[model samples]
Target: MYDEILLPVAPVGEANDAITHAVGLAERYDATVHVVSAADTAVDTLAGPRTGAFSERLVDAAEERVEAVTDELEAAGVETVGSVARGDPLEVIENAIEDGADIVVMPSHTRRGIRRLLLGSVTEKVIRVASVPVVTVPMAESEAEGERSDAAVDDVGGASGSR
Candidate 1:
């Protein structure tokens, strides 16, 4: 029943689950998948002219992310379009929705309790505000474990348990 499927990804490379899910849904519905990545450029004025350079990097990373996902979708035989936008992620996603997305498919990170509270959640916010259906693919267990391990290492000043 979907004519256009929207997939919003971060610049990270951990969205395979969401991509797979979107591919299946798009194939089933014969819908075009529109992949979008948001470059979060919200910065304080104290950053000054450096903000332009930093924003460019973010936008470039976001463009790469969109291209990667679009390639994956097209390789899977799904028609796809992609773009990178600069702004708050939620706002970017909402604008995509308004642009003609029938539904949204995205990955939800595995963060809990204090971490979840502190880091906040774009997926949660999207679910709350989206006018169309939002399908969330839970992050793979291995990915979640990797994130936890990375966090632990960072917490200990990059010292690993093995060393």
Candidate 2:
């Protein structure tokens, strides 16, 4: 049902669950997956130049994040690639879709109230704008934390290999 899939990476701290979940979906669909960093879009651009150090730093960090994700996915034999850009989370994600994503697999932290109002809705925006489906894994910090055990994550017919 989907072709190219966009799996936006958050951080080792916040996104561990998202990555694991996205990987499962990618494997099931035999899709060419992209593990991109959402950091560039989360930065404070008004505080820095278009190509400023802050932006550079953000992209650099994102590069590292994507690299780690690529390592994980590639080891699993999932076809994976990555990229970065700056804008509203939804807009940047839409750009990824434009580049060739057919679906976006994301995890929601499920924050609500003033936080959602002030920061606006990213996944909501993606759903509204994307021509493709966006499958969101429920935010499960607890399960994610414990997923290192084999009982949790199913192998993507994956093998352990180096990045």
Best candidate, lDDT: 1
Candidate 1 global TM-score: 0.85
Local accuracy of candidate 2 as per-residue lDDT tens digits, 55-78:
555556667767887888888888
Please tell me which predicted candidate would have the highest TM-score against the true structure: 1
TM-score of each: 0.85, 0.71
lDDT of 1 at 130: 96
lDDT of 1 by residue, 1-163 (tens): 9999999877545445888999999999999999988766665234687867766666776677788889888899999999877667787889999999999998776777877776567788889999999998887988656545543111101111210
**How many Å off is the CA of 126 in candidate 1?**
0.3
lDDT, candidate 1, equals 0.74
